[model samples]
Target: MRRYVFGRLGQVILTLLIYVTLVYFLLQAMPGDITMMYLSNPKIPQAAREELKKQLGLDQSLFMQYVSYMKNFFRGELGVSFSQYPKPVWDILMEKLPRTFVLFLTANVFSFYVGFVMGKVIAWRRGKVIDYAATVVGITFWTAFYPLLALVVIWIFAYNLKWLPLNQFIDPRLWSAAPFTANQVFGNMVYGAAIIGIGIFFIFYYLLRGLKPSRRSRAQAWALACALIAAVLFVAARKGMLIYIWDITRHMILPVFTLTLINFAGTMLLMRDSMLETVQEDYVMAARAKGLPDKVVRDRYAARTALLPTVTSLVLSLASSMSGGMVTETMFSWPGLGQTLFAAALSNDYPLATGALAFTGIFLLIAHFIADILYAVLDPRITYTGQSGV
Candidate 1:
């Protein structure tokens, strides 16, 4: 288990390293001299311009700059932003990241559980009217363009009815009353803990039941570790944040609804198809023949095996969440990584752009690592050697 985890962690590090190098060098190779762009003053002497270039380290060779940048990066320095002069690139990203994280995190919550349950039901009742209707809706949204759907949602909720805020992530007015308090931060942590706790409990329940001592003990360890962490946070959280949480939820309604609607279709369809296929396997029929309870036959015999593809979809959704909803964020004027990346491009802010892109690559690779961990946790019969435990 230790070796498997270390191996995956190494792969994640390598992937991020390659991504940073590629994004940096590719930006350098792009047309137009950024130094010239920055020195737009026609009256400035060539020597003065050269000095400015030297100051920004644009005069250095790419290799040296890369080495220097990496050394600072390893020490938690993201360098100063070109546009937001004197402010660190890391600081800029951190300001915008939370809003984007909340947007994607909320969307994932709706898409994942709703898709899983709906898919399961539709597959179980295939050929019924509800099934066909769901299939049609799923495929339609799956194929629909995100911007178009987002516009439709905006028109309905923001324009026609005027139900939701048309732009930005928060109602700034709410801050007048409460300000940015530790309460909101702690409230978020508490909510996160509860969610994690429920998920870990199910992992233990599904995989540990009737298992051998070693296998069951591993599941118990995971359960206790997760529970302890969550319990600590839950105990510490302040309920006062719930007041500000209301405002966050209000702003979240439109974009979250739009992105979640767009993402829901594909996950549901894929999960349904996977389940449908798995349920038709010979073992499902054999399990039914052995007089197992219907729920037992469905869950133990069918659902577990059917979950692999859905798990992949889940991980991909999680990775994309880190990228933030580019179109959605833009349309809503949300300050997310998507909007920030666009700003970086326009300003020719390579450090910020590269750092954001690198974070995204790391997010994707970590999501894959998590999926791997989940696979082993959900199915004790799965092994690090890429074989069934049997």
Candidate 2:
């Protein structure tokens, strides 16, 4: 395991090195330079333009520039943006990072958990109306384009029905006007405390079940504990913080809904297919022959075996999500890495654009590596064995 892990890490390093090098050279090969952006005014003197180019290090050889860029990257600097209002590229990107991350995290977790559960249940209940309904819905959403799906939801809920807000990341009126009252704060705390109580109950009674601990049960316990903590932080914020969070949540409803819809169908179908296949295996039939109940036969024997592909799908989906939901984010006008990347591209901010792309590549590679590690954990039959597949 250690040998495989170390080998994988070495490969990741080499991959990232090549990725960064390629992105830098590609951006360099693009027409125009930042000096031109700064010298947009026709009256700007030639000597001043030359001085600015020299200052921006545009006058340096490609090899030397690449060396300096790598050094800055190592030092946690992504260089400076050449926007009209110049600032550190990292600072601009960092400002929007959390929003993008939280958006993807919430959507991915929601879609995967709900879809997997629905898939398993429906698959277990195959040949029934529920199964047909779920399959049809999953296929429909899966076939639809993401942006088109988002627009449909927007038109139905936000445009025609008026059930949800549209576009803005926050309700400007509520945030800019009324603030959370003391009663609101206290009430939210009480609400949060109640959730925590429920979480603890589930963790002990439902999860422990007074038996030996298993990975699934332990994971449930931890998930509840983490959810409890997040609920507390989110719900118990003071007057000033509460309003902003509330507004954000309200606005996030549409975008989150759109993302969840996009992710739900494919995963659900995958799980359903995998479970259907696993149920017909010899071991599953043997479990049935051993007088195991239907639920036990399906869950412990079939679903457990079916989980491998679902887990791999989850790893890839989550890794890709870390790059930010560009289409969804764009449609919603959300301030996120996706939007920032678009802005940088339009304005010819090479450093920022390259940095964002590099970050995306790094995320994909790391996620792949993590997925490789997870395969062994999810299935005992999987082993490295210094093989070609991994």
Candidate 3:
């Protein structure tokens, strides 16, 4: 196991290096230099532009520049943004990243839960009305054009019904009187949400792990989890923090809803297919022969085994989501890593753009490493034998 982990870690490092190098060179290969953005203004003198280029180390040979960038990157210095001059690229990303994380993380988690649950039920109840209804709805949403769907959702929920915020991460008017920045509020929200998630997970784990398959015990567990959530919210309200969190959440509803609709269908379909295949396995038939309850047989014997592929897809999706959803962020007027990357690329902010892409690549590599480890844990038959596939 140790050997496998170390091997994967080494591969991650090598892959990250290749990804970063590619991002740097590709950005450099763009049509115009960063200085060209400034030179478009006639008042910016030629000598000043030359001085700026030299200051930015653009005057150096491509190889030298690449070497310097790699050195600085290893040392955790991402340099300054050309567009937002003098502000470090890391700072901009930091400010934007929390928003992206909060939004996509919430969306992905909720979508996965919904997909897994719905898929499990549909798969177990194949050919039933519920299965047909869910499959049709999921497919419909899945096949819809995402941007147009988002617009329609917004138009219905935000514009016509006035049920949610129209766009942007927060309502500026509401936040104007707040003492903290939106980033700070988002950070607090993330921490609060983490606590809530951990608390709920423990409730489900400790309360249901050894319990027999029954509606009563499951109901108790869910009740406790819901109570925990409410308690967290109550505490936040007592501490005068709920208002800020609520504001952000209200703004988040439309995008989260739209994203869930778009993504959950794929997960559901994948889970359903996997579950169908697993149900035909010998162990599942043995479980049925033992006269186990339908739910137990399906969940324990079939669903867990079927979950492997879905888990893999989920991990990759989560990692890719860290890159940010460009269209989603733009459509919602949300400032996130995706929007930042888009703007940086358009403006030729090499440091910011390259850093964003490299950051995403690193996460993807890490996710693959994690997925490999998870495979062994989820299935004992998946053993590490020092092979590349392992």
Point to the candidate with the largest TM-score. Answer: 3
Query: Each candidate's lDDT (Cα)?
Result: 0.76, 0.77, 0.86
1 or 3: which has the higher TM-score?
Answer: 3
The 10-residue segment of model 2 with minimum total lDDT is 181-190
Model 1 pairs whose backbones collide: none
lDDT, candidate 1, 106-169, per-residue tens: 7887888778878887887889998999888877887798788888888988999998888876
Residues 210-310, candidate 2: write the lDDT tens digits: 44336687677788788887867764463356655566667778887877777787778889999999988999999999997887787778887898899
TM-scores of all models?
0.84, 0.80, 0.89
Query: How many clashing residue pairs appear in each of the predictions shown?
Result: 0, 0, 0
Which RMSD values do the candidates have, in order? 4.7, 5.7, 2.9
Candidate 1 wrong stretches, greater than 4 Å = 38-45, 181-239, 290-296, 385-390
Worst 10 residues of 1 by lDDT: 206-215
Model 2 stretches with alpha carbons more than 4 Å out: 1-6, 38-40, 126-129, 174-235, 238-243, 319-324, 383-390
Candidate 3 local lDDT, 185-285, one digit each (tens): 78878878889887886777654345456678888878988888888778778867778888999999999999899889878989999999998999999
